[model samples]
Target: MSSAFEVRGGNRLQGEIVPQGAKNEALQIISAVMLTPEKVTISNIPDIVDVNLLIELLGDAGVRINRVSRDVCEFQADNIDLDYLQGPEFKKKSGRLRGSVMIAGPLLARFGKAFIPKPGGDKIGRRRLDTHIIGFERLGAKFIYDSDDNFFRLETNGLKGTYMLLDEPSVTGTANILMAAVMAEGTTTIYNAACEPYLQQLCRMLTRMGAKIQGIGSNMLIIEGVKYLGGCEHTMLPDMIEIGSFIGLAAMTQSEITIKNAGVEHLGIIPEKFRQLGINLEIRGNDIYIPSQETYEIQTFLDGSILTVSDHPWPGFTPDLLSIVLVVATQAKGSVMIHQKMFESRLFFVDKLIDMGAQIVLCDPHRAVVIGLGRQHALRGITMSSPDIRAGVSLLIAALSAEGKSTIQNIDQIDRGYQYIDERLRKLGADIRRV
Candidate 1:
């Protein structure tokens, strides 16, 4: 596949861009489709690599999939081929995506048996499967790990709901347990649950499909098991991470861009976090209007200490956007310490930015100190490889604001999440070409 983004920097991009459907939400929502045999119609699904791969994996598992439109599709899992899941081919196919682990939840909940390969995704850091495994075990599922094949077999005669306080509010883990608990024998209370908008959207979609869930936007969730789940239509929210990236892009490139249908209410601490960087944002009736910034300054704390941005669970800054935040800070007028608590390797990409003439100190695996250039120093763009989804876009943003042409290879990493990112950026008058 063609996979390099050639970017011409120093363009004052202008126009309105609508964020694509959320990638994380699509993964969780599509996995939940397997819980019911009825047709589940979903709208606003992003045409990204990972989502498409998950859809293809579902099709290979004998789930009926229909493409209603570019942004709409229907999925039905009435005829899952269980034997195929046990074969070597299943492991080879399902191992391609981390989202594939989510299928185990519905399969175990519905059929009482599931075989899943060890999932594959960006190697940003060690993304623990303990949360998923222990959560399933807590829901009364018997799990077997085959170290030889690196596969997992989960079986249960019946799932019995119980209290499960997650070690961390893992978004995918919460979605998996929520799917399993919805059809269990009794009520399940999940504390310290991931309450991100993605999980909230998943819970809302499950509710529309006749599942009982309380605490839509809190760390604690109460789910009462139900026997049957019917089909329902669910629409994914706009990709908030992409929106945050776009906001960073506009600020770094001094562009005037308006983000449409931004779902402003659901952006928990995102806009506030951006405001902390002194990047001005105006919300006009569900749209975010970012004017071309001449001088965006970073903020300091109350005691006049330098501000520090860090990632936490939901209601805190999302770790996914910290890369974008780090990129945006490169051009701000002040200094900020970026503490990426979730993923260790995520902050390592700052070396690439430093190579482009940005002042950055790679303090450690999880932290970086960036002293903004204040538009006085123009970054000279160079070739780089995208390390992961977020970092790829972060580099792309840096390239867009830099002084010369930049070539970002391994753009497949970026494609995994962002939908036709080059095309989307071009719509905003960005001179980016996918070569």
Candidate 2:
């Protein structure tokens, strides 16, 4: 069923909200359960569409699943039906989810063979699987592509440890390679690996399951292969992207909002970047409190130049929150440049903002200059369609602050990442309805 959100704007929201579990981390961690046949208990799983679909796919493959609660589950892949990987049903289900590709590594490592269909996700840009395939080939896996059926087959007699330097620090690629390397013959050293907190969490969970990994939170990793892994329990971190979105939501709506248990320590440079945009936010232990305000100013650089926000690797600003930052800037008090360095199509949603009365210039596919309207002339509502996950929430934020009623279509894209967003927004006094 298709859905849309009809939002009546100009309402100030005030309340406390808790972020859901990390979506990116959950994808990697859930896929890792395939590495062992023992029962793996995972907690704090987000009740979102994508995660639920992945869990359903695992069940269809014969993994024993125990739904301990809505947010907790135990998975035992003792009797997986490997033949299901070649069926049309598996291809249909896996093709809808990009995270499905992560399963290939564990399947190849344990069973010496794996099948992966062409994966799909956000249409933000070209997310290639070359990094994953190239890493597998380096570890003694033979790769074959069936172009007619749009499938990838990987087989190996036995994977041997090797030294590999990734062309780019792809997060999912690094996780895929790490899962495969944990059970190989000798020793594997991966240079230029992604060191995101999500990757660190995966490493910690794998370590608890008897995987020998060195350098938990660094770019270089060394892993000594083991014969088998045991089952372990894992708790996911709070969604940093959702926390960032809440911060932006409060700023744009001029509302007082408190984010409970935001996992502040893990949010690298996110709050600081919002602070650079002159959004007033305070950290109280692990929680973040954003007070309602009339106006905020964008800070200029020390040399009295326009401040430019760009995405980089971890310990830097995350690319996922750039859309929220761009939307928040539309109502601020100065001009700034948003440089979406990672994905070219990310900034395309600025056209929708421009139609809503935001003073933005689409400089190119990768950059945009937003001149703050200062709330002197309020944005008027209009019907728009969400292009991707980040952009979808960004449009929701814009709609909540606009002058009148607005309709946002394609909310499935939004539901893919955020959990019960419309219901949560209503708790904070937002006039939004799902139709």
Candidate 3:
């Protein structure tokens, strides 16, 4: 794979599509396998570029991993190779994916020291690791910053659980602290913890392995530090971001689709946001039903006022779904405001959509006003480069709805999260090809 994708437009996707396992959850859980040297089995792992790179990272670190089947793998981290951490290739792999930063806590917990490069992900905004560093500092880890080399070294005499409050609820930060806290010496109480489903799953897996944790679903977490964690079997949840993406896809192309085993319980306040956009979603058992509705209108607030869909911490609308919401709003009947509070630069993709004939007002860096031109204006196909993973997929969705075949380069950004996207969308009758 050349780390880019050529997307062909002018196809209406039509078929049943079940999303792959959650990439966000998979990364953390896979790293947690290093908490102990025993073999741990994880199921429902997504086959994606980032995951493949992570597997290679694990192998480089001397962790033994075996693929029992397509959806199952066993990992053993008994022998870690420290020599592998000194090269540019290692940092390159880690720097390309945000999940790479997550390994620091586990590696530090087990080895008492870890070396990590400055983490990287989408170029949309300044995704800070200060929250992560602060969390580790609460656990008594010492940090060294090398601005010249762009590397970070974390070491600690011993980890002790203390009363820590995150300045902001960063998802990866919570996971890092949870991993380090499990092996710490005393009780650690984390207030304002990010309780996203991925973090929740990581906490559950830790508990199953004999780590005592309380307040699993709230902003506060209590972890009783233990000596060692045992091996256990765990599975990653379905990707809610994918579910939201598919919802946008079905609406944009006017297609009927069903999302299976969507883990709706984890989608707090997500479906409600989509409903305001006049997109009807039906919940039947564990599956989601989206019928082909011709005219999707923007619904107003309870006071008959214009609505604003903003991102917040967990239990609030997710920052990941903001891109999809912005794209889907292009075809909606009325106007709505999108406030991307977490990442300042995430709203930049509106320019690409505006070039495609969507009416979007970028109100500063943190907000945008989307006055949907309805389905009357056909977005003409144009050559556009993907900016970020979520925005890349959102642009792909727009390209699918454009008048002619469109070309979107830099699809490697899209591939980081979505697994076999071309294949899965092809099954849904989407006319997308990779060259």
Candidate 4:
């Protein structure tokens, strides 16, 4: 069924909503589960398309899956069919979700070989797999990209510990290599590794499962290979990106909403970045309480230059939030520049916001200059298609603030990341329906 959101704007939402499990964390943790033969139970899994598809892909490979609850599941990968990787259905399933490639790390670590199709997810930009394969090759694994079959083949009689300096702190790449390095013999050192909350949680869980890892929150990691790993239960943190989106939604709609269990400590620099846009986000305990506001003025830099919100590595602003920030800036009291340094095509969605009466200048592919309307002018509803997951939610926020009904199509992109977003918003008094 094709799904679209019918949003009736100009309603002030009010309620408390909890964030779902982090999708990025879930993907890496699920891939790591394939490393051991014992049962690995995980809770707080999001009921979204991408995660569900990855679960299905794992099941197709002969892993025993039990749905303990809507947000809980257990997996036992003791009897995986290695030959399944070469099958057509495997390729078809793996190609649709990018997380499928992460399984190669575990397969290579435990089974001595892996064959994975060139995976796919969002078309945000050129997300390379070089770091993952390079780390593997450095650890005595042989890798070959077969252009003829459009798949990656990896084999290793035994993986040995080695020192690797990643070219960049690629999140998934770092996770893939980390999973593989844990069981490799000797001590493995990875410098310039990604230390996102996702990786930190994964490493913590791996430690509970008996893997020796040093450096929890830093870019440098040391892993002493373990002979075996046992089963352990892990809980994912509430999605920080979703919490940021909700704050933007609350501000845009002038709603008083409390975001519960928001994992505030793990949300580094996100709240501060939102504060730069003059949003009043109060951290009451672990919850984010956003009071209704008519107009929040954007803050200028210390030098009186235009405020610039750009994406950087961990502990800095994220590129994923740039789309939401751009949409929320449309109603602010001042001008701001949004620079998405990671992906070139991410800022192109500003044209759709422009059509809805936003004062925005799309300066090339990577930058956008947004002049605030300061709530003086209301946006009129317009039909638009969602290009990606983050953009899809940004469009939803824009529609909620518009004066009339808006239909946002291609919302499957949104569903792939956010779990039951419409239902959750409705609980917050939003006038949204899925059609």
Candidate 5:
């Protein structure tokens, strides 16, 4: 792929679009596969850049993998070569995805040591790994920050679990600690754990692998460490973020679209968030039907006041989808305050929306006020560049809804998270092409 892409937009996307598996969940699940020395089959893995890159990293680590189908992968972790996993190739691959941080605890638990490089994801803002480090330390792991190498090397003779409380509900931090705790010598109690569906899936996978874990869907978790883990087959849930993004896209373009196989159980607080922007959705069986509601009016609270949409940790609204929410609010009828507390730079993309004729105010690095266009003014298309993954997709939706042709550059950032977005949108009658 090139360093960037040029997208010609301005088409009303329509038709049914099925989202790929959850990229975030897939990453954590794949990393968890390394906990056992048996074959683990993972179905519904998204064939995006991140998953492909992580699979290549796993292959380099000497884990045997085979593609059973387009979205199904069979993984055997019996032969991970430590020497192959410790070099620059590992760092190069691991640094490309934030989920790479999740491998630290699993590798340490399985091999007694691990060298994890700093992870990379969207340049939205500062994502601290302090919670992860502290959690592992409480589980009897010592970390060595290799200042010269820019890697954090963690070692342990044998993991011993203990009771600990998390300062914040960090998703990846909870995943890392959970992986470590599953194989520790004693019982590990984790309080304030993020009880997202992905965490529940991870716990289920661990249980199938013969590890004892309790408190599956709450802030507290008690894990009885086991001697070893076996392998199992699991299917990933649908990507709720993708579903939400598509809902925003359909609303922005005034298109009737259906999102198939969206896991509603994991979609807590999402429909409510979109409802705040007056984007009505119809649920038919497992699919979400978003009709063209061009006359969108932001629904105020019961107190009859302005509404605010803020991103929090898991189970709360996801910070990853805030950019999409902000974009969706621009087309509604009322004003809203979008609070992005997780990342300092996520709200920076509002400038592009502002340039596209959306009324937005950058209150600070973490907050923005969006005044809806009241469906009177259509956004005029213009040349724009993507800065990050979610922002890039948000721009695409804006461009698709714009009146004229718009070109978006740096779309590779968008491709990192979304799989074949142009082709998929084209299938939905979107006039999008990559150049």
Candidate 6:
């Protein structure tokens, strides 16, 4: 059974909210616990659905898990049951999470074999495993795909490190290949790798575990093989996506919000993008303070042209926050174009905004023109279903800023990425309840 959120909009929310742990970082770091048999202590673990599901999968794989607190845990994979990977339970559980695919690298590196069924997650666009598979193949792992059961099997007598250039700067692919190459024979040089902050955190954690990796925050990485890895403690950075969402939320609702401990150092180009949208935000140390505004104007280019916001690799704007940006622009003073370069279906949620009286023109599957209403007319909420994680939160923000009452169905999508969002919003004076 699924649940929904019944939100009474038009409230000016005001409060200080702390962001949860980085979900993307937690997924990669938790899966990395399988690389060593020693105890690995990780703090700032987010209690969201997707992350908790990954922890459950790890526990089911026979990892010794100790929950120190709501946001901390210790993991030991000394007694993993290799046979469990062949069971139906593993297939059913692992197939539900896209993060399950990440374990293949650790398993293959440490145990010489890995098995995984087709993983599932948000259906935003075409997410291919070619980078991961090709990287593994370059490192001397034999790959076999079973189309009937939708399973992938990989094994290696011994992995020998080699040079490989990724076709794309895939974050998960880089993390996966990095974990595998750290334990292989000889040196592995990976060019065109992802250099996101989360990936850099992974490299630092691996370095603490005695892995020799160069180029922590660059597109190229060189890793020297090691015979074994030891355990180390790691702390997750505050989720930048959530910070971006809260910034957007503050703008959309015209509320005063302070996001505490936002990890602003890692939030490259995010604050500037929001500033470009004409939202007023102040960076007080690590905290982001968004002031309430009656109306904010969108900036035009110096050439007197419309502004365009698009997603790119790290140091560029994140694709995850583009949905929030699109939603926030609905009521600004000027027009802006949202170019969703990564995912084709991400812009489809604008129709829900359009239904709420937002002046938006969906030019194509990947582009939309949002003409700011400038609060000339308030949006009228209606019932809608969330399409994906980012889209779900974007819709929730839209509903919170709309007039009258609104119902958001498929809230599980929101829960997968956000922890107790309704409860947290309530602290900021939002009249939202789970139904």
Q: Which one wins on lDDT?
A: 2
In model 2, the runs with Cα more than 4 Å from the true position are none
CA-lDDT, candidates in order: 0.92, 0.95, 0.87, 0.92, 0.86, 0.94
Q: 1-435, model 4: which lDDT tens digit per residue?
A: 678999999999999999999999999999888999999999999889989998999999999999999899999999999888778889888989988988988888898898777757786888888898899999999988889879989999999999999999999998999999999999999999989998999999999999999998899999999989999999999998999999999999999999999999999999998899999989999999999998899999999999999999897887889999999999999999999998978987888899999999988899999999999998889999998999999999999999999999999999999998999999888899999
Judged by lDDT against the true structure, how good is candidate 1? Answer: 0.92
Q: List the residue pairs that clash in candidate 6.
A: none
Off by over 4 Å in 3: 1-10, 86-89
Off by over 4 Å in 1: none
Candidate 5 has its poorest 10 consecutive residues by lDDT at 1-10
Per-prediction TM-score, please? 0.98, 0.99, 0.96, 0.99, 0.97, 0.99
lDDT of model 4 at position 150:
94
lDDT of 4 at 397: 98
Work out how many backbone clashes candidate 4 has. 0
- Assess the local accuracy of residue 342 in candidate 2 as a C-alpha lDDT between 0 and 100: 90
Question: Model 1: per-residue lDDT, tens digit, 205-281?
Answer: 99999999999899999999999999999999999999999999999999999999999998989999999999999
Residue pairs of candidate 4 with colliding backbone atoms: none
Clashes of 2: 0
Q: Which 10 successive residues of model 4 have the least lDDT summed?
A: 114-123
In the predicted model 3, the residue pairs found to clash are 5-411
Per-residue alpha-carbon lDDT of model 6 for 1-435, expressed as tens digits? 799999999999999999999999999999999999999999999999989988999999999999999899999999999999878899988888999999999999999999877768988988889899999999999999989888999999999999999999999999999999999999999999999999999999999999999989999999999999999999999999999999999999999999999999999999999999999999999999999999999999999999999999997899999999999999899999999998879888888899999999999999999999999988998999999999999999999999999999999999999999999999999999999
lDDT of 3: 0.87
Which segments of candidate 5 are over 4 A away from where they belong?
1-10
Candidate 1 colliding pairs? none
Model 2: per-residue Cα lDDT at residue 326: 95
